[model samples]
Target: MGKKDKKKEKDVGKEIVKDKKKKSKVVKSEDGIPIITAASAIILIGIAIYGYTVYQDLAQVPEMPELDLNVWWGQNTTEPQDTSIRPYRIVFSDAMESEIRWLFEMYRRPNKKKSFEDTAWNYGVHSEAFAQFFSYWIFKYSFIQRPKFLNKFDHFKTNIQGLDIHYIHVKPNVDANTKVLPLLLLHGWPGSVREFYEAIPLLTTKREGYDFVFEVIVPSLPGFVFSEAPARRGLSPHQMAIIMRNLMHRIGHKQYYVQGGDFGHAVGSNIATIFPNDVLGFHTNLPVNFSKLAYLTWVFGSVWPTFVAGEHVDKLYPFADKVKFLLEEFGYMHLQSTKPDTVGIALQDSPAGLAAYVLDKFMIFTDPANKNDPEGGVQKYFTYDKLLDNIMLHWISGSIATSMRLYKECIADAEVEQVFSQIPTPVPTWGLRFKHELAHSPDFVLKWKYPNLVGTTNVDFGGHFAAFERPEEFSSDVFKAVKAFLSFKK
Candidate 1:
């Protein structure tokens, strides 16, 4: 009876094992390879579609146009080449002076309560400070003397792209045989060729140790001062670079060095990007753009401060504080970028308003601490006469509104990021970081964006207006950069 029961149990187990094997085979045949193949095919198709879409977008972007040197003010002039660099002068008319006086006397000041907090500038120019500046503009400042002061530099104008470009072309007081290097100096917004007044002497003067002397050319950017505004819209920094390059070429400088700050930084960078062959070297007081590698390195640098920041660890790390400061300061940029016409109209009509607007930058950008003072500490660094002269250039020329339009045109352009990203500046570059710069960028970050960055100089003094604040230091740095470039080329 036991033997028969054991035999039956063994046969039942064998039957159960066979049934399990048959079910496993059916499951693999039905779903395994086909399901995997379908998922893999779907992923491949998605990748291919994304790749094609990006390729299409990149293909549609327009390339920058070549500059037309022959088209002078859109008229075919058979005039000789010698007359191209015509002598120019600034003449402040009686009508302009009368209007400026009336506007200053009739200005209606806004009611602003004094704040014990350091955020007074958060509300814009201090009313009392603006009042004082307006008083100097109306009564004390001499408009007649401005032209004489400006004429001290060799002023000239050349028609380029249907607009008259005004620039101060000063050569070193040397013999014809002397090899003087051409250096283009570009000024930023709320500033004119006046900014380089102090730096000009320093650059042109032949110092003992410095091997090269500069033939300084400081141009009032298009839509600033005497330079005519763009007839059409969309004159971005890149377009301005084209005009500037053409101006250099017309001046008989095939290859030249460039130095700039603020908006000038953008223009100079674009010049180096688009026409690297023409730019011998580029230097800037303010350098923009932070690559992905910079961000990652910044994070790691936060942990090991000495590796990336060195002595400037405080300036580079604690990112939250820097971001907070930028949020407070970037309000003007927002207004100018979106609807410049709103404030531009106010600035155009009222001389007092224009003075307040431009002088506010002079006060704060010179040193943020100046915001706390009653007169904005403007007189601490800059003379009232000098500041008023700069304003007169804008007022007499009626270029304030058009000059502000650059922010609108460049920022609103859809291809701004694409154009900036695609262009890599292979030319040698140097950066100067002043203590109170709008944003203090470390050397590591500069190297990330500028592949051929030769050096970076950090100074304790000066802010956004480094060239104006410390001309000696600025000129010395320029000399260093030029020397470095010459060395690198060898």
Candidate 2:
């Protein structure tokens, strides 16, 4: 016989031997003939136990919550007791718009002062107060206002973990699937769930047979915007991970994928690590190296000095670079993380200050070359609607103080720790690198934070807000990573 035939015959012989042994061990009492009844009973019991195990494995998947998408598209006029609106409509009249235009024209006509810091403090104080006040007013108005832009999806209000989370869900028209892969998206500081609004349509669209239909969940970080702010202190990113995992389990998605950028990167990573069995994978724009020894070697070798020296053009970012980035890019972090109560007063009182403080991030976060090009930077990185939308969430929620406090709470215990330590994640990971992204390189990414990075792609287009700025590139790269992760099974 051929090798295949011989192997098949050997497997059959083994099966026969096993069955004969089981039959020979059957307990027969006073019966003259050997009792086959005892052997049959033993076989039945084994079959029943095996069936139950298979049933349990199939039963673990959670169900999707029934949500009404229309409520999100409708007007929201309800005013909560804790919040107040600032009167912006009273201050900047339509006539002021025309006059400011003429005033700027006259001011730029000839030689102007190179810089102005004479009343810097006074100006800053006034700006923050005005921003805080106006943010609330504009936000409330927009909440009830009609949306001019057209999109395929609708928004909804869902209560998760006793807190209200505003989310958006989309389903494709051409090839709708009853069940879809769940994708949870998380945003970082100075940003809200509004960041992914533009990419929702592109994400929900199908891609031939490989269409991994996604039921996307985008929740604002607690206290950041719409989500309820916790009154107690000491809620770290790890705690948030627990809440997210629970939310996933409660929502019937025991297995799901996650994506994050900025502060959300930490939360996403934490979720993957603490709940690896339940998580399918995790993706982040920011990946850091965990090994302190490796970092020190690079620092001593002089290859990782740009980040240390505060230069924006850094090749290998180290812990020192992270510190520098925080010191510079995070003025808000200082105020909110350190003395939340003191700064919250200024942001809550002044609308202009809030606008300047919040808008400043947009100015710095965009490509440096496009700083002066106002039309391009904000629009390119995030849409005009999204920027205004996110800012409005902060304004309307009146949680600026509470949100800033979260930074302080999360970092309180590890104030002086050099490296972040957490559980190892079994989830597959994907990293996207944009050319103009603030501080990211493959070497830096692998060295600083993310250790289990399975795929990293460098894209030619986009900047900080990769998903919003360049949807086509962002979606394609995201889908590619999804394919790679789906194919990898441990």
Residue pairs with backbone atoms closer than 3 Å in model 1 (clashes): none
Tens-digit lDDT string for candidate 1 (43-83): 99999999888665443334554545344433344665443
- The estimated TM-scores of all candidates read 0.81, 0.64
Which stretches in model 2 have alpha-carbon errors above 4 Å? 1-153, 157-162, 173-179, 290-298, 301-314, 317-327, 369-376, 415-422, 441-452
Q: What is the lDDT of residue 48 in candidate 1?
A: 100
lDDT agreement with native, every candidate: 0.79, 0.59
Candidate closest to the true structure, highest lDDT: 1
Q: How many clashing pairs per prediction, in order?
A: 0, 25
Per-residue lDDT of model 2, residues 322-347, tens digit only: 55655656676666768988888787
Q: Give residue 216's error in model 1 in angstroms.
A: 0.9
Error of 2 at 20 (Å): 95
